[model samples]
Target: MGRAGPAGAAQESSLRLACVWEEPPAMGTCFGLPCDVDSRDEDSSQTLFFHPSTYGSKIRLYESCQVAERIDSFHDGIIFTSRPIHLHERVTLKILKKEGPWHGGLRVGFTSMDPLEIDASLLPPFACPNLVLQGRTWAAVLPDVCGEEDTVLTFWVDHRGRVFFGRQQGVQDILLLKGVPVRAPLWAIVDVYGHTKAVQLLDPTRLCGDAGEPAPPLSPFQSDVLHAPACREFHGRPQGCTEPCVICFSHETSALLHPCGHASFCYCCAQKVFRRSGLCPLCRGQIQNISQARLGT
Candidate 1:
């Protein structure tokens, strides 16, 4: 070539750099690896906040997009996450306000369609039976136990695409609905409908561990990944063996969580967990009752 343009010269220089070294000039990364690894790591640790633009007309965002409140009407309180959530990523929300005169509590679930793609004006006043009926959307009204003001709730989608709900201060998440269609990436959807008026997003890091404290409550997502297979072993106690509770490591395992049926705690430690988070330390299943582990079990 007689003369290389500036763009061509830049491309040639990049190729030369690539050939000269397996890694770019950066210290920690290779040529093919993303240079923004730190940014991605930061993002992975960031909590999910309310989407600023993709929400219902009646919904008002506040506190740097951490709080979402229904302004005029209860029905138009639909809102979504700032970005798509990963599978099994637990989303936590606190009820800031409630409308007692209204008939229902909050309705929450997931949708396969992107909220950003849908016009906010086109979103229905309610999430259930309206958007849910349209297909690819699923939502269930939270029971009154989960709707009290200041109550913190956590919801997540399992690998099966089933949606589960729970209270941070109460029992573990119960199955809200199952068979959520997995066509596209899912976005969390919440309708501050009925008795629910306003909700706030909670930072997940707070649940991971606290500063200068003992090990934080085992994260449901983390436990789900680590001990899923071992959790099944709790269905029955091994003969002639006394396995200590996972939490205390002092008491023999005794408590049995309901529905999901994972028994991983002693009766005493189980009570402590119930009083704290009401979740199974092993499977994160809702601890409905703590029964004595049967001799055969």
Candidate 2:
């Protein structure tokens, strides 16, 4: 589909195809988010254009291709087409500018009908534009910064559309937003396994589809864990175990005090205690240091 310029001339010269194809929303449909679609004229005769077949029936047309127009605006503008469009679909459109290059770029906002129904693949490529998804409940760095230290920004969205960014560096250094409900489908699952940072979109059928159960709200504790830094080593494993206070039975009569104030215990006992209380069984202290023990004989 295409947008008509002033004087009824469709400017094909300025048409730059978007790298990714977006689904358009249907006519007169409530987007369920804060945005506005501007008409070419005072009269609302011009509907945002899109091919109903390829890009999906629903599409969100940006009121102006220039990013500054949508930034910080309480409402965003989009054209929703009523067809399922795939990646790589090409289309042409016009973007307005402020008469200078200093203030022009594309910006778009997103809010999921079901926050839990999001698919990671559907998320705009890392940093394409600022995204406000799940009722403005959660925010993440553009997909491009998936694995960088301090690159992720986790925040909570209140019912009033206000977002509270999470704090960094502390026991609660979690990057996942708190109090957000995982509705049904799990949109993004980030796996940080052994030097690999992979994000996978869940299948609707296995997650929020017919067979899936509604997701529950994230518990305060779970939120903390999700945002914590990646733990390189298994906390209490025999190999590469780094709890300094660990008490080694091989040293018949001495106990160690981990710098982080955890009780020292052997590999086997530490494992057992971690399973039971997830704390130092002997002193009832929270385990922090995970270094190996020195034999004090």
Q: Model 1 clash pairs?
A: 104-195, 165-173, 237-297
Best by TM-score, which number?
1
Off by over 4 Å in 2: 1-110, 115-127, 130-153, 168-297
C-alpha lDDT of residue 32 in model 2? 42
Taking the tens digit of each residue's C-alpha lDDT, what string does model 1 give over 1-297? Answer: 111233444433442232212112122221223443222232454447776456776676654466677766447778888666667888888887776565556878886666546766688776765776666676776777778877878898886767888776764558777766443467788888766777887876564444222223325664243323324333465677666554444466676766556655577766766776565544345667677664334
Tens-digit lDDT string for candidate 2 (1-297):
222223322222221122122223232133343244211122222222221111111121111110111122211222222221111121111222111211112222222333213332253322112233213212322222222322222333333323233222222422222233222111111111111121111112223335233233335764343333322322233543333222222222122324333324455545544454454332223555444444332
- Candidate 2 residue-pair clash tally: 42
Per-candidate TM-score against the hidden true structure: 0.55, 0.19
**Candidate no. 2 TM-score:** 0.19
- What are the RMSD figures for all models against the true structure? 23.1, 22.9
The ten-residue window of minimal lDDT in model 2 covers 60-69
